[model samples]
Target: MSLPITKSRFCISYSISKFSRFFPNPSSLSSFYSQSPSVDVHDSQPPSDDVQDFVSQFHSMFHMRPVPPINQFQKILGSLAKMKHYSTTISLFKQMELKGIQSNLVILSIIINCLCELGQMRCSFSVLAKILRLGYHPDVIALNTLMRGLCRNSDVKKALTFHDKAVAQGFRFNEVTYGILINGLCKGGETEAAIKLLRIVEGGLCKCNVVMYSPIIDSLFKDNLAKEAYDLVTKMISNKIMPDACIYNIMIHALCKERRIKEAKNVLAVMVKTYVKPTCVTLNILMDWYSLVNEMKSAEHIFNTMTQLKVTPTIISYNIMISGLLKNKRVDEAMNIFQEMPKRNMVPDRVTYNILLDGLCKSGRISNVWDLIDEMHYRNQQPNVITYTCVIHAFCKNYHLDKAFELFKIMMKKGIQPSMHTWNIFIDGMCKGGRLQEAQKIFQYLLIKGYPLNVFCYSTMINGLCKEGLIDEALTLWSKMEDNGCLPDTVTFEIMIRALFEKDEIDKAETFLREMILRGLMT
Candidate 1:
């Protein structure tokens, strides 16, 4: 029997029972966590263990005692919220509904928050509607939660409009309300509007804080307004606010991207003078820029400097170094650094393996690829689509079609769905190997499966038919692809033109040449 009494009562109740031990009564709820829970309740997720314990306690208290007061349910919801157990919080809220506990702003706010976090904004608005129906205007916190939720879902324009109407209705706004709008605007690539909002803060509309300022400064830097960003930082400092490492790193990265390494170094010097310690991100960006500019010597100097400063290189740092080395064709040095990663207690992620695999494949070190594959399994890392694609591409490139097909089957059997790129690889490989019939079968399967047939897929198939002297079939496929709304690209047009020329169909080829010109697709 599910505690909430839904249709699948047995299944629901069994699910509730799993965490029933953590259910809290009014008597036990106050001292549950040593730290008093937050009221803001947005994204304050507790660790998994704490969450599990809270669940167990809630379940116990619910079944053992008479139903607690509504306030007690609110407290439990808040705690579940801090744990980010949103679904569980909603479930418990439904259970509260079943017990005849009337909804109050406190409980409704918690529900609204969970709905927002779950990206069910319509449901959150419905909860807001319920609060209004019960003659309770949502507090600023509740309203802010809704606005932030809209921002998170990338509905910044809607959030802006919502806030504007609320203000028109005489709902007073706070710093948090403004902050949410500013953050939303900056993230949505409307930094100009965000800067204008920050000016409102400067005019004493609201007190400025780091949270409101940081994103605008970062966005300014992103828009290549480095001087303006620095000017804003200066203003912040004038107001006795010190810039954090994140802001400094943004400046460093912007400078590096513009290849103004000297200016980036100047910013680093200022950071050093201010006693702001450089992070791995700071070092990695510098190293990445140096390597990209073919200045490996400078990159190595920074790598060595990190060791001297007692700052441990993160996996990202190592990955950057290895990638830089591989691009410079220093394969041996790349391998050595990869080997050193384990010594630093760093586990290699998929990117790390992919880089090494690419380098090995390019160098024709096929035997070493399997060794890395075995090591990936040992480390509990499953090879993803990119991993399989890399190996398949290598096999196809090396004329190992049988091996490529074998691996393709293995990936599918393991439930790794082949991406369009994967299909293209096999199709192109078959076409190159003069296996036109096999390529045609794969093309037919793609159509039957209703996978999006892109220009490359169509071009590859048409090219295969042309190679086999089947001009009529190729032309039919071309017409079919166009009818299916797959717009032909330059390569597709060129393929058809060449095929028509080969078959002495000069008039049809001229028509296509004119059509290509009309579409502005000719290179």
Candidate 2:
């Protein structure tokens, strides 16, 4: 094994000696040179700040008389790799190589690690070839890093083939080896294979941990195979391994999403029984689910229970409560909760402000928005594009186009770029207000800016044209919509069909209705 560089034997002296011939003031660094290098090959832990500082100084002396020791170069490169500065590490390694400094196996592995991180799997293979050419046996670390890269790139099949070859060659694999493969396969939608691999680990090929099993369980839940996921949980408990709160949270959220309230509560009970305390996120998930299904009473009860259990409600919890109340049109209750947020020492975020604005705007309380905007500014929560967009949408809804245009100007002055949603809102509003020429100008601008126009945009424009008794113009837009790869939805088809029939073009309406049925969008 390669050892750490010592104060007595660092090749830095040759560089300093060469530098001293040009400058008389090398004395300041003399005492620094006496200190030992901090990074050691045997220390498998991550690099410290001191090691990084040392590497910085080390790289600065690259042009000096003597090249750095290969072990020291490897240590710095490894540290850089660990810090996720993959490109910098690779560059340093190239400098080492150009100086004819022969890299050992450890340095070769670091190079592989860097290459893998950069997603340059092809280049990583070239390094492996060079390792073999140098007559250095490639170690498991190098192989594992390569597989990790492939997994990251979603090339699980190639990773598995390489892994199988290593196994056939009698290369011993560890938990990390299995973890990488299992996680990759699960993410790649090969959850069934991932579970089969997990069984192999359970069969004594390797030890299974939460890291290996969690992804599989999460995937199973996404696939709605909750029963199979629960089976794995039971097997895990039988193996004497306790699942983490995250695992239980996944199951709870999935069950709650499917409206299995009783089962979700049972899972929560199991979490409490297992001594895995439910986090604020867990309670928030339940609260959000109840709120979404319009079970306001149950949602309120859960929020109250959180306070009783001394689990402080998060901003998300408050947002959910306020938004839910507003969604149910209980604006007074939402405002009460909104005002209560400050007493809890949590300032309202942009979402909170937006929700309040949306409710106020819909209720024709546009005057209240200015005060809320002032409050947001006081809280240092600058309104983003969504905030401005919501307010602009309110103006459009109230038919105050000039005021909406004024706010749009202010938003631009604040350097906030309007999103595609903002453009869509403006176009829809103009179309509804019978400003067909203005709407057409915005639509043409959207096309010029390469905006991905949605079905709503197409439907709105076509509806506007048809309402203005311009049937030919609406048909031309429908053709362009299809040709530009924006598939018309049922609403789009409905608008066109209604327009064609209004113009007494029965054949086209019949043809489109048939097309809609064939596309399975209609029966």
Candidate 3:
């Protein structure tokens, strides 16, 4: 497919002299847009029935005796692009070009957007060049797409340069242009530059909106310039540009990160007072923060407030409360929340099950765990490695080594790859259950399989040996651990030093103690 060379009313005569610096040879890029390249088009078809049917209709229109209007084709392409079927959009555009359909700025802009989304920046720019070559002036949307493509690729500097050069060449950009640049600057860690740009835009270049202010404010907080971020919020409000829920969330999250809960609450109060209704995200952030800080009462208050405000709590809301209650050892309250979830039409996710399982295991409420696991199965929520490990840990703590081993075997049989922590738990369990020989066998197996055995792994085996009065064997393993490039940590040395002292090996104990001190593991 080729872009029609004929000039239409949509075409404009413009010079490519300024853009020449970015693309050294405008003519060289012509071949790129003249036809889609022979490279493999990695387009994944959208699964929507409606989209598929629309695509079918689009393909059928291509075979029509008198083809559909260009705007009709543009509409189809635009719809596909809007649905994020970027690859499909590009492919369909190529087909239209092959069919000799006349292209316009709107159609080319869609192609540019698709290329940008697909990270084909080079091709996206080539399309721009084709627009200029065809005597069609590229609109701000097209220019913004290119800038955004550059920013998405993390080449914000190039985007900034493009912006300056475009402005110098008498191209008037709008708020969308500045928004793209500001977001790029913020993401690239040029918060200061972004703020300066915001100031410039605020001073009559374009009316600064929340889109431009949000990124700068967020960047300020991330850079630990909280006061500046808050000041920008004030500036935004004073300019009569009300902060959205997103901005409020950013402020509250930042304050929470700094452990300024009171300040965060004050911001939330301000949001409510302004009649800018808090979104689910706004309350979720506050709920999560309260949970994290163990302020269960405050968390409960937020939870209650959500219902009162008619903002339905999401599954995440329930999960956060359950997790917080679990952490604070209020397992019963967590269970109550878990039970209330289904009543609220909130189905518990794997995370909810895992949290409850872990809490029950830690609380030694093993009897309740089996029923929960059964419920998880009934809900089609298969227990993951974490779930099995929690139960195994509980069993090991209760000296039910056989039961722990049984669960471990079940996990492996179900194709669940145990994590290093899981392996450590089982090995420690065996060692504590006087199954040192079995523990040693597993450790050796892990070594032979080239598992990344950590210091804890080695220390666990060493402690088991020392407890079994096998000091010589423990020392030999310690030497092998070092040889394998696993350095002994403070706990490892502490185990050895204490073992040596208990065995009346004074000289060896003193030597390890001194080494520990020299290594800064001890004062």
Candidate number achieving the greatest lDDT relative to the actual structure: 3
| Residue lDDT tens for model 1, 39-105 | 3333346346776676666566566556666677678779888768786777666655655568689
Worst 10 residues of 3 by lDDT: 4-13
The alpha-carbon root-mean-square deviation between model 2 and the true structure, to one decimal in Å, is 12.5
> Distance (Å) between predicted and true CA of 202, model 2?
3.1
Q: Pick the candidate with the highest TM-score.
A: 3
Cα deviation of 274, candidate 2, in Å: 1.4
1-523: candidate 2 lDDT, tens digit per residue: 1111113221101122222122113353232223333333433345567656856765675766676566777777776777676666666666666556677988888877877877877667767767767887777788888889988998776676666555555677788988898888888888877776777777677688888888999999999898989898888889988899888888899899889987998999988997888889989998899888899998899888997777899999999999889888898899999999889898999889998988888777899898999999999889999899999999988788878888889999999999888988888888887788999998988888888999999899999999999988998998999999999999998998898898899998899899999999887
Superposition-based RMSD of candidate 1 using all C-alpha atoms, in angstroms: 11.4
Q: How does each model score on lDDT?
A: 0.80, 0.80, 0.85
Q: Would you list the rank order by lDDT, best first?
A: 3, 1, 2
Better of 2 and 3 by TM-score: 3
Q: What range of 10 consecutive residues in model 1 has the weakest lDDT sum?
A: 1-10
Q: Determine which window of 10 residues in candidate 2 has minimal summed lDDT.
A: 5-14
Ranked candidates, highest TM-score first? 3, 1, 2
Better of 1 and 2 by TM-score: 1
Candidate 1 runs further than 4 Å off: 1-50, 63-83, 89-114, 122-143, 157-174, 224-242, 307-313, 339-345, 447-452, 458-523
